[model samples]
Target: MALKPKDIALRAASALVLAPAAVLAIWAGGFWFTGLIVLGGIMLALEWARMSEPQDWRAVGMAVAAGVIAPVIAAHIGQMSLAFVLLVFGAAIAGLVSNRRGGEGLDGAYGVLYLGWPCILLVWMRDLNADQGLYWTVLVFAVAWAADILAYLVGSAVGGPKLWPRFSPNKTWSGFIGGLLAGMIAGGVMAAWLDMGALTAFWGAVLGLLAALATMGGDLWESALKRRFGVKDAGNLIPGHGGLLDRVDGLMFAVIVVAIGRLIVLMIGGNA
Candidate 1:
């Protein structure tokens, strides 16, 4: 399939707006950064709830509340474990509320956890250190961005078998391989730019591959969810992106992967 001119223009225009704002917020790496994560989480929750249980305002409310609460817990209390516990509790509440309101309880719970954890982890990643915070956050974004863009381009140019027809028919194996390569290159470049050394650059490339795979999974998951809900797009909130959730779905998953990897390394090094 060929890429549409209008789609390209819209994507470019949207990138023009979103890219600068995201880079600026990440570079700041403080309340500004946290605020952006919070906003993204809330938007994701809203989109999820609206898509999964369209008539259930209670589900939306619960998810959004959980989204807001989780990040606050992470940023203010700085207790990740406690924040996760709170998120679980919130999900339980959301599930119960949805059930009572004649909706799917599991969907409510899923929505909260799906959007909440990533937002908290993103803040946690940025708060790791004053010097390394920006580098780490930007590195993850670079991987996701590079993968998404390259995948789109390659898939359109090298049309072939779908990667997963059941979930995302548009994605192709060619796109997947191309995206992984682009992600690795982007990750290595970012690591070098940060002066993190060759070893770190190699690991960054590896992480980029892992992150790109995770991102593809994330995108597929959302596509499946939308299909389940019989929706074309999550929302029309963003000009080219469809919704904030649409834009960050892959990022949310990639952030968790990168954060977990970082945490494991920190623990092994006795810094966690």
Candidate 2:
């Protein structure tokens, strides 16, 4: 029996609600968040390698190192500016050297950028002020969820212009607009609740929308990879979603952009 859309939606929404609370709770304890994020980074690394051609172990090692180090640096680094420069340099060098042949080079390049680095920003966001950081963590997650759900719902009903006909046939431009609007609303509400500034609203709305758009991009990006690799789904990890990569692709892009945005803001004293 094929599950009804409503049923699938209900389960997804439930999971979204419960999962982050669990994560936030776990993260509050000493080293729990760090440990969990590292574990996720490793798992995501392994999954990405399996998805790519000729599974590069060096890439896997890079992911492992990133998983362990980036979060720790973000959590404890005294000078975030210098530390971030070094982290980016390390990731670039690792991506440059992770693989020798095959299309896996391109895959390896984006995979580290996609999988390993942005997570550092998320960790920094999580540790911004413990109390404040928790909300930031939850906000990013919630914003992504809101955009995805809204896009799906509106996309189904309206079914207007396709966002990208080549990559994702099912995605409609209507869904894109819906996601942007939904993200804006979600970000606004979170900003008000958190007492964040107008600039937070700016990044939140812009980044939130970009996150939603990139979420679709991430979906299609993996879809293209799997199709090229002659596989169905990234892996059998998630129930409905293909794999952790499939689930996180959008958030991955979103966080990276948001992290860069944050870095820029911090550099220019925009946070104040």
Candidate 3:
């Protein structure tokens, strides 16, 4: 269905407010960035809990909150290995708790990995290089945001065949293509402008395309999860955006891919 003017306005307004705050947090780094992420993680956990197991949402929320937060804190303190180990441990704990509470144990565990890993990776990525970290972090945000906005706009305007009606009925092939192009352009421009280490504009665009692909996959995954749980939106946290999870689903997946890619390049002695 076409979005009404009011819905579009609401989305734009929310983005206007939230995007600036997020960017400011990224620029601030350290405690500011970590705090923003922790707050977001908590909100995402609550949404996931309510969506997956409304009956015992509070219990599940607490489990997920603990699961995501500990790893984030560890990452913030420069303990990458410990952060990862804590992530696994937290997931296991969440699973056990959910199972004991008569909820989907596997889903609960998956949620932790899904939400927590990205948070850790994001923190790690921002701390990769004091000088370059800001640029890299901003690049990820820009690409994801560009792709998301363009996809929604183009998809609605050029409404055509569905991309995957099974999971997301409103998604269209046109939107996917639009998002991909936007991601590539955004990545290329950011890289060229910021001069991210040895990464060239061409390579940046390629990474952008990869991130965009991952973003779409992430979106589909969340959609499938919501469908499985029979919820329309994750939660009514944001007016038109649904929940924190709904807003950052793509970013969560893209950040993991980008972080891993950066690490691999660093290890191989490349300056990407």
Clash count, one per candidate: 0, 2, 0
The TM-score of candidate 2 is 0.75
In model 3, which runs have C-alpha deviations exceeding 4 angstroms?
A: 1-3, 268-272
Which pairs clash inside model 3?
A: none
**Model 1 lDDT per residue over 12-79, tens place:** 89999888988999998888888777766767777777888888764566555674566555654478
lDDT comparing candidate 2 with the true structure:
0.63
Candidate 3 TM-score, true structure as reference: 0.97
Worst 10 residues of 2 by lDDT: 96-105
- State the TM-score for model 1: 0.93
Using lDDT as the measure, name the better of candidate 2 and candidate 3. 3
**Best-fitting candidate, scored by TM-score:** 3
Badly placed stretches (over 4 Å) of model 1 are 196-199, 268-272
- Judged by TM-score relative to the true structure, which candidate is superior, 1 or 3? 3
Error of 2 at 114 (Å): 1.9
